[model samples]
Target: MFNKILVANRGEIALRVIRAAREMGVKSVAVHSTADSDAMHVRMADESVCIGPPSSQQSYLSIPAIIAACEITGAEAIHPGYGFLSENAGFVQVIEDHGLTFIGPTAEHIRIMGDKITAKDTMKKLGVPCVPGSEGGVATLDEAKKLGAEIGYPVIIKATAGGGGKGMKVAQTAKDMERAFQTARAEGKSNFGNDEVYIEKYLTTPRHIEIQVFGDGKGRAVHLGERDCSLQRRHQKVFEEAPGPAISAEERARIGKVCADAMADISYIGAGTIEFLYENGEFYFIEMNTRLQVEHPVTEGIFGVDLVREQIRVASGLPMEFTQENLKINGHAIEVRLNAEKLPNFRPSPGRISQYHAPGGLGVRMDSALYDGYSIPPYYDSLIGKLIVHGRDRPEALARLGRALGELIIDGVDTTIPLFRALLEEEAVQTGAYNIHWLEHWLETNLGEA
Candidate 1:
């Protein structure tokens, strides 16, 4: 076990990793930017260091600064709690070269899975179902048009190195193919520094379901069930639930086993998620997240396991304490992100939090770093906290989540709380009958009233 570890990010995820490390008797070092001087994670960590200013490029994303901090603190490992450099293959390789363990997958695995084109091809060879499209990246607009025509109308163009809905476009017909291809390529180059784009037969009304899998470096792996993340806006997940309400127990088991087997086949290490799009009782591979996901809490709630702790253990050369048989879904769990943004417009609201209160009760968990009078830095994501609730079933979980959301309060800033309050009452959301496009459609139709 590592004696000390540096948390290489900020906000609630940094705090989340700190708490988990404490539970395992590991000391934590928090690295923060000047903008986060009063951040809760820095206040709670065993030690803290100021790496740079507010800009992410000079601070949270600075590899040299983080490496220097680790050296100065004598930290044995780095736990990149999502975002920033969590999925950067170069960052992983550098940390290992510095003789520090990265509490994630190997650089080779990250490199392979980080690229959408290679990831899809690998999954296809592993017998995982994939959406029909071009065999590889569509390098030219002509090729994209040819592939789009062959795959039929309504295809999606995606960046090979894209995420969070960036570098993605949809073409409903051949006329739209040229613009979609150019836009996707330009955005991919701008955002991920790669102009590689791939085409896929877009599925309408598909549900975004992902399976959480963990593996030891030497081929042993297990699945902890699935999370329904269909509630999204602009390709970012807004709400998530465990034991996806749309799939049956048999379907869940089959998919989970397939993911575990695929991980073992590649000798994948640490924690990763295999994301899929589901429609008409069929699952198609979308992409793989090479690090812990933002919506991982829902999976932890149902499985009664600390995923961070497991990541640390496996990274420390320890085998998982349990097997697939030892894992069982206990109940339904739901999580809603409390972003500091306004509904309808969804504009970022960054300012001081005058009054902050979190709901508490049985099966309700709040992961946040906000406190009264803390200034929210606009340089980071709008997410201020996460509200998670567990219950015997989906209905019970929904009821609990509604009650908790009502009790939670944050002043001096616009938030998405009202949006969720309204969403909880929607018939489709309550019945779990919505698809990936449902949220966007709801926003267009109901944002005025909300």
Candidate 2:
């Protein structure tokens, strides 16, 4: 096992990994920007390093700064929690060159899955179902139009390297094709620096379901089932739940095995998530996240496993602790992201925390880095914490979420607590009858542009 691992990101995710490392008797190194010198993760780690200024590119996203921090602190491996350089294939190669372990998938795997086009092709070749679309990137407007018309109307044009809802556009008809295609390409070039784009059949009313799979890089893998992340705004997931409400036990088993077997065939290492669009009892591969997910805790909640620890163990060449048979979903788990944003508009609200109170009770877990006086920097993500609750079933979990939200208190700055509190009263949320568009439509109907 690694004696010390450096957490290469910030906020709650860094704290999440540090907690797991502490439990496994491994020292942790927290690298922070000068702006985050007083952050909770830095204060908690066994050692902390100041990488650079407040700017993420010069600090958190700097490859050399992180590598230098690892060398200076003698951290044998680096755990990239979610964003920044977590899915950067070149960074993985750099880590390998320096003989430092990367606590995630291999560079080859990341490179393959990082680009949406290649990932879809790879999955299709592996017998995973995919939506009808282009075989590769379309290089011209004519080609895009041809594929869009062939795939039928209501097709989505997506950037080959896009994420977080950027560089994606939908054309509802042939007349909408040219404008949507041009906008998508322009967004792709500006946002991702890649003009490459692909076309796919967009599923109306499809649910965003993802299967979490872990592999040992030795032809063995297991799935931790699915998370329903359909509730979103601008393609960013806000609420997520494990044992997806729409997926039955039989459906879970079928998809879980398919995802696990696909990873096993590739000898994939560490943690990965195979995301899909599910509609009318069929699953279509969307893309694969090559690193740990933001909503991983809910999966952990239902499975009773520490995913961060498992990631470290696998990167250290240890055998998987659980097999396919050993894994079983224990209960339903739900997670809501508490963002530092004003209610109704969801605008960023960053500032000091005059008072901080975490919800406590059976089956409620709060993952945050906030304290009584910690001033949230305006440079980072708006998400301040994640509140997860587990119960024997979805209703109990929903009720517990409602109860816990009331107990939690984050003062001195506006938050999304009220949004969630209002969301609980809706029958659609209670019955889990909403699709991917449900939340957006609800936001418009009830709150308008939140």
Candidate 3:
């Protein structure tokens, strides 16, 4: 096991990694920007380093700075919690070249799965179902139009290197193809520095489901089941639940095994998520997140597993602690992201948190770095925290989430608490009947009332 590991991110996830390391008897090094001088992760870690200014490009995303921090602190490994350089293949190679273990998958896997077109092709070859689309990246508008026609109408154009809804456009007809292609290409180039884009058949009401799989880097792997992330806004997940309410036990087992078998085939190491779009009882591969996901806690709650510890153990050349037979879904878990944003508009609200309080009870967990008097810098993502609740069943989980959200409080900044409070009252949400587009449509029709 590594004696010390550097956490190369910020906010709640950074703290999450630090806590996990501490529990495993591993020293932690927290790297922070000037803006996060007083961040909780820094205060909690065994050692700390100031990487750069507040801007993420100069700080959290600085590969050189993080490597230097590891050298200075004698950290043996780096645990990129989620964002920033977590999925950067180049960064992983750099760390490996420097003889430092990256607590994630191999750089080769990251590179192959980072590109949308290559990822789809790989999954398709592995016998995982995929959405019909161009065989590879559509190089020209003419090619995009051809593929759109072949795939039928209501096709979507997506940046090969994109995520979080960026560099994506939906075209309902051939007339919309040109604009969609151009826009997707431009956004991809501007955001990810890649102009590559691909086309896929867009299902209007598909549910977004993802399977969580873990591998020991030695061809041994297991699946922890699925998480229903269909509750989304503008293609970004807003709410997530474990053991998707809409899927049957048999279907869950089949998909979970498929994901695990795929990982085993590739000898994939560490934790990864294989995402799909489900409609009419069919699952189509969308993408794979090669790192720990933001909503991983829900899976942990239901499966009673510590994913971060497993990730670290895998990186240290240890086999997974359990097999598929040892894993069993115990209950339903729900997670509501509490971002520093105003309800309805969802505009970013970053400032000093004058007051803060977290809900506590059986099966309720809050992952956050906020405290009274802590200033939330506007230089990063708006997610400030997450409230997770588990219950014996979905209905009980929903009820617990409502009580937990009501008990939580954050002052001096607009938050999405009101939005969640309203969502709890919706029958679709309560009964788990929502699709990926449900949240966006609900906001458009009910934001005024909310």
Candidate 4:
């Protein structure tokens, strides 16, 4: 096991990693920007270093500054807790080159899976089902238009190296395809440094389901089951639930086996997620997240597995402690992301929180670093915390989540808590009949209502 590790991110996830490391008797090093001088992660870790200014390019994403911090603190490994440089293959390689372990996947695996084109082709070779469309990236609008025609209308143009709903556009007609294709390409180039875009058929009313897979360095891998990320807004997940209510026992087995086989075939290591779009009882591979997802806590709540700890253990050359048989779902778990933003009209509301209170009690877990008078900087992600709840079943879980959300109190900034509270009361959400567009539609109908 590593004696010390450096966390290369910020916010609640950084704090979450610090607590996990403490439990295992591992010292933690936190590297923060000037803007995060008073951040909770810095205060909680055994050691903290200021990397750079508030801008991500000079700070959180700065490889040299982070590597220097690790060397100065004698940290043996770096844990990137989602976002920033977590999925950057080049960053992972740099860390290894500097004789530090990147507590995720090998650079080779990250390189292959980080790019959507290669990842999709690899999945196809492993017999994992993928959406029908282009075979590789389309360099020109003419190529995209041709592919769009072949795949029929209502196709999505996606960036090969994209995530977080960036560099993506949906085209419902040939005319829309021309503009969307160019726009997606431009955004991809600016956001990911890769303008490579691919075409995929868009499924109507699709449910977002992802299987969490973990592999030891020795080629052994197993899935922890599925999370229903169907509750999303603008193609980004806002809520997540484990043991997806939409999938059955047989479907779960099929999905799990397929994901494990795909990973084993590719020699994938560490923690990763294979996302799928489900519609009309069919699952189509969408993309793979090459790092730990932000919604991993809900899976931990249901499966009794500490995914971050497992990632560290795997990086340390330890074997997987359990097999597929040892993994079983216990109950329903739901996670609501508490973003520092407002609804109906999307905008960032960053300021010192006058009043801050987190929910507690049985089946409730809050992961955050916010407190009274803490200034939320708009220079980064709007997320402030994650509120996760577990129960015997979906209905029970929903009830618990509702109560937990009601108990949460945050002042001096507009939050999405009120929006989620309204969502919980929606009949469609209560019945598990909502799809990816449900939340956005609900917001439109109720955001401005009296």
- Candidates in order, TM-scores: namely 0.99, 0.99, 0.99, 0.97
lDDT scores for all predictions? 0.93, 0.94, 0.94, 0.90
Against the hidden true structure, what lDDT does model 3 obtain? 0.94
Sort all candidates by lDDT, best to worst: 2, 3, 1, 4
The count of residue-pair clashes in candidate 1 stands at 0
For residues 86-119, write the lDDT of model 4, one tens digit per residue: 9888999899899899999888888888888998
Q: lDDT per residue, candidate 1, 299-373, as tens digits?
A: 999989999999999899888877999899999999999999976798999999999999999999999999999
Cα error, candidate 1, residue 132 (Å): 0.5
Model 2 scores worst on lDDT over the 10 consecutive residues at 144-153
lDDT of 1: 0.93
lDDT of 2: 0.94
> Per-residue CA lDDT of candidate 3, range 1-450, in tens?
999999999999999999999999999999999999999999999999999999998999999999999999999999999989999999999999999999999999999899999999999999899999988988998888888888999999999999989999999999999999999999999999999999999998999999999998888889999999998888889899998999999999899889999999999999999999999999999999999999999999999999999999889987889899989899999999999997667889999999999999999999999999999999999999999999999999999999999899899999999989999999999889999988888888988522
**True-vs-predicted CA distance for residue 29, candidate 1, Å:** 0.2
Which residue pairs collide in model 3, if any?
A: none
Q: List clash counts for every candidate, in order.
A: 0, 0, 0, 1
